[model samples]
Target: MHAPMPLISTMVGGLVLAFILGMLAHRVKISPLVGYLAAGIIVGPFTPGYVADLSLAPQLAELGVIMLMFGVGLHFSINDLLAVKHIAIPGAILQIAAATLLGFCLGQMLGWSLITGILFGLCLSTASTVVLLRAMEERQLITTKKGKIAIGWLVVEDLVMVLALVLFPVITEMLSKEGVSPTEILYSLIITLTKVIAFIAFMLIIGKRVIPWLLIRAARTDSDELFTLAVLAISIGIAFGAVELFDVSFALGAFFAGVILNGTEFSHRATNNTLPLRDAFAVLFFVSVGMLFNPAVILESPFALIGTLFIILLGKSIIAYGLVRFFKHSKETALTVSISLAQIGEFAFILAGLGLALGIADSKLHNLVLAGAILSISINPFLFTIADKFALSRLRKNTTLTDTTSKETAKPIDKQQPMMPFSDHIVIVGYGIIGQKLLSELNDANEEVVIVDHGKEKVRLLKMEGHHVILGDGISEEVLTLSGIAKAKWLFITLDNPYETAQIMQMTKSLASHVKIVTYGSHLDEIEYLYDQGAYEVIEVKKDIAITMASKVIPSL
Candidate 1:
């Protein structure tokens, strides 16, 4: 029998293991990221099983990072960042400085050189884009004030790391040559900043127009395959070009590419088409991280591991919390932002790998960073749960105090009937064509309807039309609650994305068991899956259209 190619074997093995473990993780009510990581460790060289090609795994993982950052860029606009800039920019920088100093101190205690310690410190200073985004997406916080700050904070961190990556070689060379002056370092910094600024300008001035025009052309071809291909090509091509021509990170390049395309009419369509690839590659990225871990680190350097975790989980979080609170944000927002950034991932790995390549950091430091990443990521969800409960308790206490004060100071007024809360209403999850039609019919029948949609413009228009609308992803619990799902008589999901549709159905079923859910699907398997997920009715859109056409023509005949 012929041997399988290295690339093929690595991809197959990694994905198969990730799926099995991811499912198990889900079954156990933990983040599937835990399972993906476990799968990596099992298939890694450290274990006595079929090891995937270590060389190729990282390359694939890089693609995952690129895709992920692109997705973030699509959702994130320059305006969103500006809104949170007062906190995100300064907060991220200060927090990074604090974390780096802590890491540097720890490295000094371990007897590492100044350069090595600096690099080590830098590795632990930044949060992983994948982990933070995943957590925010799960809680439906990506569009919220808190989510915007966290994302903005992360963007600042990523930018700093990119600059560091550019300057690492110069700094290392300076260290080697005793005659190198501070002016040389300053010049290098200026040059690097210029390149970054130039790249940004190019994207905003040229890319914003060109990328969208290309997508519009592709979309006009009326081929789903071609449109999707165009998106992938643009994302990957721009990312590659950024690295090669602009000497910037792929994540930053892809991010700008997404940002440029975010203004286009086709942004939503682009997101839907690329969602699956983004998800699949993200899984591989986590697995690739796991494969780098050596379980022996726990036993061999127990103190080192503890120190690393302490810095990542406690030191960084505390610093972030302080920074956010100092900026006059609420305790809840501070807690959420701090806890969300408690782990390090892709950028850490990149920095660590660069340190190794440059001979400034050793294997031990790399392993420590990897171990820290795995442990921190695994426990991040549990931390969020604890934080949520704590926040809830505080809110309850405040509510109770307010109620007590109201009772003590209340004066009797002319007795008046209180306004009734919205209930027994129909909730429409999307404001697309089907949603618009449903709303019109429901309004004509005198039924109360609440609209839940992610499109800002759509939600604004709906509200202007005097419709009750919650502007957020339907999958978010907060959005569902705002839509009054508990008292909703009928829930209609008009979203085109099957994954999102299923998620909405499942969340709705859990939140309001009595409400009926009706959704439309284009495929038989998707329809069946939606039914399995507790959808009351799943309309087969294509089948329905065909049947309707045939019925009309046959009647005429």
Candidate 2:
């Protein structure tokens, strides 16, 4: 009988344990990353269980890294990046330097060599892309100014790490030699930089044109399977090719691939198609990180592990916060950026592994970095919660202060008059095509309507057009209150997302039981569920469209 395949066993074991633990972690109201990491530990060599093929797990994790970076690239906005560059570039560089210095100081305390200390410092300097993005996305901060600054800061860090990875080996090799000429070292650095510049130039100049052309062609086939295949092929193939040909990291290659497709017509579709794979692989990436961690390090080098965590969670965060504050950014922005960067991830692993292979770092150092990564990633979300509470409290204090000042400065009136709230008005949750049409009809009928939307540009335009608008998620209780949902006669949700519409209906019902909720469902299955959720009317979109079209044809006949 044939023995079990290691690849199948590892994949199955990793994914199964990850799902179970991830659900448990979610149930406990913590990040699922903690669960994924715990799953890795259970099946890891350090634990007394059926250990996975460590080698194969990392290779799989690498694919996850590629996919994660590709997703980042897909959402990457050049204008957003440019908008925050004044702060991002300087803040990132200074924060990295400060973190690196902290790590190096720790290394010196540990009696490590100069080069080893620098390498260790470099590993601790950069934040994890996966962790930061997930945190930002979950909090719905991806479209905010603070989020743009954080993402831009991350892009700068990634670029610096890419250059560091290139120069690392060359510097190590030079230090290994005696009497190496400055000219030779400079020449080597120049050559490495040239290769990187060339790869970027080629991707931007040629890959941009050719990759989009290929995607368009694949899309023209009118087959979703083919389109998805083309997307995956482009991401993985370009990443693999970049490593082999240009000597760049897979993350960079896949990132540029996603960037090339970012603004294309099918970019959103491409992102949706690859999301599952990206999420799966990203979990694997975290698990692989967990496997690298040895719990024994907690006992053997307890202080060192503590120090590493300090650098990752505390030292680096303080530096980032200071840099952002120094740059004249708001306290909220500074807190968000600093806390978001309080974790080291993929690049740290890559650097640690490289150092170990080069005999520059020992297994102890490697395990310390891994332990630091696992702990930092798990604790990051909690830090964000604390930061958010603090920011909210500060906001409340400032708002109260401003209100008191305005009250004292105002001229005394004969009697204080209360502002009237909108009542007997219609609340529109979205401003899409359907929403626009409904608004037009309502306007013609001379009905009062209040608009609630999350899009900045849409809200600005609505306000400019002299419409009553509230800028926030429709399902938010605060947003609904601001829209006067409690007094509104009707709530119309024209959002394309059925789940969000259902949520809005529930929220509206809770706030204003008498308010009628009218929404649309894309599928027949959703209509009953929506109605059960307290929707007064659920228009089955496809059925309604067919009926309307048939009416037009029959009338013509």
Candidate 3:
């Protein structure tokens, strides 16, 4: 019989074990990451029985990093990122410095060299992207202000780590007993930074145009398989190219690729399409990391492990919390951000590996870093879950103060858009660009209207402006009822979202069968479908645009 293929067997073994453990973790009310890592340790070469292919594991896991970083880029919003940069940029730098100092002190006590200590300190300074993103997702806080700040803080850390990766060799030589020249250090730093900057510039300037245009062209082929292939290609291809040409990390490359793609209209579709693959590969990534961990380190270097964990889990967290509170944010925001940064992952492992290769970190340090990472990551979710409850409880106690408070009492009244009740009026769903223009024309014609929007901020602004607005999802029946859908003379759904527009139309028909429904679709392809979904009239936006342009340029036609 032919020998079992390591690739297939490794994937199968890791996935199966991870699933069993993940399910158990779920039942016990813990992060599935705990189980995934446990699964890795079991199949890892350290534990002995049915060890997964050591060499093959990393190759599989690397895909996970590429895909996960790619997804990060996909959701990386420039506008939201900018809004929190004031705090995120400086906060991340200071917090990292604090953690490094704590680690350095601990390293010095252990009699480690300056270079080894610096490497150790750097390893503990950054949090795992996988762990933080999962925590935020579990709590559905990704779009909240707290989530935005935490993500932005992480972005800065990732950038710093990327630069550190560039300067790794220089720092190793400069800080060692056999020190290098200031000129050599400067030369290396300048060269590494130049490559990094050039990579970012190229990705933003050239990649921004090429990537979106490429996706648009691929999407026009109307092939789901091809579109998915195209996205994966861009993500992996750029990640590989960045490492080869620019001496940057593949994760950074994939991340920028996602950021550029985020600017396109097809971004949402792209996110939904590849999310499954990203998620699957992400599981592999965690499992592979687990495989490298030697559980014996717990018994082998008990004190060292504890010290590393102290710096990573407690020290770093305290620094993050204090820094956030120092900036005058509420206690809840501080706690959430603190908990988010309490663990280190991919970068720590990368640093540990590099340290081992360069003889800067001893075998003891390497294993301790792994032990610290595994334990810290496993424990992080519980910390977040506890913080979440505390914030929730505090919000309930004083709704006006805490970040997690419900909108009913916590939301400030928008003085600009005051609410007014109206009947025998049009109810417009989706206050997007088209909806806004339609409201302007109808209001000018003395046609009373009430707007329903999903965005809390938009609804607040409209309510403050005195243009009757309901701050709830248009797809919800309760929201429609609250918007006076039953009494409204007409329901005009101006949103170009065909799926949502159809659902709303169906709901409107069921609620008020006689209510007139007029809707707009961005493409003529879905016009008939919308009509079938109970729209009395469906306006085709692109077709109308084409007609208008034709009328302007060729009036006779």
Better model by TM-score: candidate 1 vs candidate 2: 2
Instruction: Write one digit per residue (lDDT tens) for candidate 1, span 166-248.
Output: 67876786777778789987887677778778889989888888888898899899999999999999999999988898877
Pairs clashing within candidate 1: none
Off by over 4 Å in 3: 173-179, 399-557
Which lDDT tens digits does candidate 2 get at residues 507-537?
Answer: 7878789999999887677888888888888
Candidate 1 segments exceeding 4 Å error: 249-251, 398-512, 517-532, 537-557
The lDDT per prediction is: 0.81, 0.82, 0.80
Task: Report backbone clashes per prediction.
Answer: 0, 0, 10
TM-score of 2: 0.81
RMSD of each: 6.6, 5.3, 8.1
TM, every model: 0.77, 0.81, 0.71
The 10-residue segment of model 3 with minimum total lDDT is 398-407
